[model samples]
Target: MNGDIKEDIRSLSLTDLEKFFADQNEKTFRANQVYEWFWKKSCRSINDMTNLSKPVRKILEDHFSFPVLHIEKEYISRDRTVKSTFRLHDRLMIEGVLIPDGNRTTACISSQVGCQLGCTFCATGLFGFKRNLAFTEIFDQVVELTNQSLHHFNVPLSNIVLMGMGEPLLNYEEVKRAILMITSEDGLGMSPQRITLSTVGIPNMIRKLADDHLRIHLAISLHTADNVKRSIIVPLNKKYPLEELRDALKYYHEKTGKRFTLEYLMFANMNDSLSDAHNLAEFCKSFPVKINLIGYNQVPDLDFKRPESGKIIAFKEFLEKKNMIVNIRKSRGEDIEAACGQLALKDRNQREG
Candidate 1:
């Protein structure tokens, strides 16, 4: 095939690859060998598959192309957190983070270049949406972050979170494919329990996730329980109100029988009051849930301020009094703009210049 007509080899499934080899009068096992190189070995080029014959490798190179992501720039925080800006084949960019704590290292990967949801407090949405990432692009982020962890912290990546730059559920198929490859025995071989997909609460997608029964964790970014305030903070809330979201989550629990996580970003005098805690407890009543009260990471031009420590403590105490599980997640990598709600492209002008 000509370069103009060639497609990404990673886009093909095993069955498709097997058939392609057979059509070329090659042994079908060549597909198996090549598949292992692609997923299990994480080979960047067909030339890297040493087990394949030179003729076979030449044929593969002629027929297919493997798109690879390059690490354009990296920033390391004082806390030892690493943020990477990946340059795609088309020259577009996205960010991923490596967060290390004690014995565990988590790779926070993105599902899209930029976010479509314009959360007032987020920096990614300030640049507007670019495009959804392909499954291979998403997987490449994990591969690089895993390498970063071993090089920097001398430990294997213990967990993976799809909580970096975009609304994951919006890019459904690509995100799902990336997760399957991340957890598949033929791929990274990590356990599904070590992976989490965080969304800003997409009701239909939440129900669809339940039906898929992926067995990975699902997290909803519920900043507030009050609908009026939520709509102002998360603009998507007006379209998918709390009542409908509640019904969808109820259906999810009934189907999967699994506990989900609710992420609440704390902002002073905004949603950190005792009354807000009561509403949150009432919302969690419908299903088994864990609450993560995250400190607000100040983004430039965003007026949201982190709540006082006393107020956050009181709010957590109130939730615990309701017998609810709660954890206060202190902001990590704030100095490097790599914490939650802080991942975005900072050199847009330089890139386009």
Candidate 2:
């Protein structure tokens, strides 16, 4: 550890905080109060903990540091979807979006500064990999977006989607820690059922999540059922493959007894045919799952286009006929580049340049 760098208080667990307080000759209860300030109040600085005595506050200020995100840019779509670009302490940028549909407001947040898995159609992959976000950084995105939903729509956030930029399972440990903080009574206190984690089907990680028995919803990005076609779009599939992914999902279902979700992006003339639908339906038969058929969101320099309405309808009808639950989720915030697979760090780079 660098001698000049103070410890980040947010990184310490409650027990660790208590130990530090004990060493300082302060009561252990002070740890609980500080934890509440760090998590419940989302305080960015020690000065904001006015409830602490001046002497204790001074000591904390000298020994600890809090790193918080600064909102760099915010955009609201005509559909009332809000997207915010946040600048980290190291100046890397990440995005979070608040999407409102009737009574439900979902916060879609990122887990990494940039993405390592170079999915061919994703904008975030264009920037290449930067680093995984700390647990506090992930938790902060939810708190910020929850506040945004309340401020803009006068409604609390009802759902969370780990689908904004990076593959969440790649940052599994920090993401899991952030989820615990979000659902803890001392923190945001949201139910696990309302949270959904979407991944690009990392097989071993999927099995690990099942072994841990986490009840939060899981979504697999399965763009196509054909192994070769899927690998072309999502390169990670080349490593995990379709057979391994299917077995992993089955294991997950058998262990948790929870139905997972399959996210399919329909691209024009690419994977939107009736045959494609039949293949997808057959794949879902391996486990209890629902299909979320998303229309492709155009990214800069990408050749793919959204499937035609007639083609989309035909494909969905085919799946429904096969007794598979299917939903066609419309792309939101397209005008502001806030739709699925559209998140990039270019704005931050341009500003820095």
Candidate 3:
């Protein structure tokens, strides 16, 4: 934290904003002006905020920088999925993706450097736990990625997905703050309906998100239904099993009346069998949810492999026979390693190599 160029202003909330203005011997109106620049305009440098006096800008710049990650490497897929790694002030790096569909562009933002969940099939989890991202850093990702791909992305981030590096719910408060900032009209001007947070079934946070009345969609990473197989792949299943997860989803639907999605990744012989698909359909019968069958993107150095095209077709057909509405998701960035579970390159890793 000491070495990182952490700007003090980045940590200020609504109350802290007033405090900072008072501490700087300025009127409270100054705080609101700065908030407009940061939240509304998404300004990075102090010089960009022209409303503030030159003397005031100088004081703020000397005290705090606009904590944002500079773009390090950008990889564009042939299909137009752009994945970029950003280097933070501390030299720590994170990845953000701009996935362009027919008329919509979704920005997949990361909540942390690495993951603590340790899901066996995921490349991000394989890296192990790193600290959660700060609020400023998290916000910077959305703004920066949007600015980077403005020319191409059909929509200005029609959807905001927390399906990147870390387990978003584990970094609860920061994720909550980031969501609030995204949803606030004064800020990113994003509608909550457009945002979807994908989790490996964090029960408590699921119910908490529902309780808070956030209208965002929930996508649960339910790779398997068998407790034994699920535990082997997703370690968090030991804490919150299928039964508990079912109850939580039930509660969430009851509270929000929103239909959640069950994200099942297809891994060759692992969880792509006909019986496994049947188990998944049976598992979700108790809750109101749709199924999004994601075809895995093979990561280098990972043991898990993507299922065959025939296997994907057979599994989707089997689920459909069970009256389940399932859509087989196309892999977005295979050529550039920017697809589902394939964002592993970082500035530190590059430097070390």
- RMSD per prediction, one decimal? 1.3, 1.3, 2.3
lDDT accuracy of residue 333 in candidate 3: 80
* Model 1 ranges with Cα > 4 A deviation: 1-5, 349-353
User: What's the CA error at residue 133 for candidate 1, in Å?
Assistant: 0.4
Instruction: State which candidate has the highest lDDT.
Output: 1
The CA lDDT of each predicted structure is 0.92, 0.90, 0.84
Residue lDDT tens for model 2, 90-115: 88789889999997899999999779
Give candidate 1's total backbone clashes: 0
> Any idea how many clashes model 2 has?
0
lDDT tens readout by residue for model 3, 110-205 = 988888888887888777766799877888898987786577763577788998889888887888888888889878888988888989998888
RMSD of 1: 1.3
